[model samples]
Target: MRYKGTKAGAIVVAAVTGSVVLAGCGDGSGSQVEGGGASPSASRSADAQEQGTTEVRAAYEKTAEAESARMTIKMNLAAAGKRITSDGEGVLDLATGDSVMTITAQDKTIEQRVVDQVLYQKVPGQNAPSGKPWIKIDLEKVAGQQGLSNQQIGDPAQTAAYAKAITDKDVTKVGTENVGGVSTTHYKVSVDVSKLPGGEQMSQQLGPTLPMQVWLDDEGRLRRQQIDLTVKAPASASAKPEGSASAQQLKMSTVMQFSDFGTEVNAEAPPADQVADMTDKALQGSRQQS
Candidate 1:
């Protein structure tokens, strides 16, 4: 089966949560759909791999028709001797990158609104000097600042790119499992992650291999997915986060759960006066620091 390269929306969670601008996730019972630690002892089969690829590809296509969905992302990782975790929930406008997502990390929770590449964030208790409750962030600016691609950071084609990453090999069906309580087929998958849409950045930092597992329903909708990756920390002027006390690698596990497909999500931005342009704020902040 061929995995079609379509425009898929993406919202990369780890970096969004880890930025010094703020900071920096779970698995299942319901979320078991996201961890890469499940080891399947079943024999490998070329036929299984091909079939799994077909199913995964179909799931991507099927979900694309879903105009909106309820999305949950849970991430856990270790970087620079510190462990980071976060949980994000919200509605996504599948056709566009527009979304209203709230991320909860430790004791802080921040809500973000997106209209295409323009992002507005509401960091609780922290407002701009102007006291605006919402700040607009230019994803393009953040991408360049962080050395990330729009897709890696999350673009409209994010899901499509993620689905396109699944190739037709090295896939093993682990049997049937319930994802989000729905009975589905479970498969453990590995890919040349460097080949994924935004995988080049991941490859640059972590090496080329990424392990993933997914649970797909008969309707070809992906109910749950998990990935695990570990990469060494490169000694660099910028890679080391400030205040880090230990030389450490970045270890991350991600689980994304999707449900309530076709749900109508009316996510809108706040009033203009309540919004502060973060693109200008970040640049201004940089200028001042310099």
Candidate 2:
């Protein structure tokens, strides 16, 4: 087993942390479809690609404006005799910086909420004590703990953050399809970890392949996303050999779906009586690390 709250809490952790990323296109396909240059068909393809890029941005742009949505996610990762599969449903609202999500992994449930920046968590063992069922976290301090100056804290502004994450990515149309009861266009992009903001954190945990795809509705709102990657596994936890890549690779795929735009996703803090302070225990490290 990896550790408590590590594999068990992956769904929610990945959901909130990875919700806002994807990418772009190239001439291989776009140009292939164009057939030849200096022709109306090529120009039409260029215009289509341009439109596709605009539509992709518009989808997230609309999301930033809408600020709230009901979403679901499913993820699976397996490598070196270990596998983790999980699913979750939740509300996303960046306007007020609030969110509520319930993730189920390994037959366990983990629920989390963020209201006005503070995080409330209820998980097995770590939190959800008999009387004090919620663990309250100071998000700013949590950011400091992770060495982040401005961490992504699920709010209306987060969509913009997502947009910024893929700003430099290359997006290409893979055709249209039905998604979440809506007509949507599919886009695909492959990227290097060095290109994304804070994406370097992924380098250590992942293999060389990172491909992401998304579906956007006619209204320019994202309805679905699928990310495929591989996780790197270290051979030894305590020591590192001179120069070596991960000893193993875990194939991973995550799918996220969005719906209920402009709906009410009220993410309120738990009552004070049922809460325990986690700044020192969970977010902040022990005295020395602090």
Q: Which candidate gets the maximum lDDT versus the true structure?
A: 2
TM-score of each: 0.69, 0.68
Model 1, span 107-200: residue lDDT tens:
6687877775677777688777678887676667644543456555444344444544555554567899877778898877665556565566
The global Cα lDDT (0 to 1) of model 1 is 0.56
On a 0 to 100 scale, what is the lDDT of residue 186 in model 1?
84
lDDT tens per residue, model 2, 10-129: 223433444453322221122122111122356677667656655664555555566678888787866545677888789877356477888787788878876776767786565444
lDDT score, residue 284, model 1? Answer: 40
Which portions of model 2 miss their true places by more than 4 Å? 1-3, 6-17, 21-41, 78-81, 116-119, 123-131, 136-169, 191-195, 198-210, 229-239, 242-252, 277-290
| CA lDDT of every candidate | 0.56, 0.57
Residue 171 lDDT in candidate 1: 59
TM-score of 1: 0.69
The number of residue pairs in model 1 that clash at the backbone is: 15
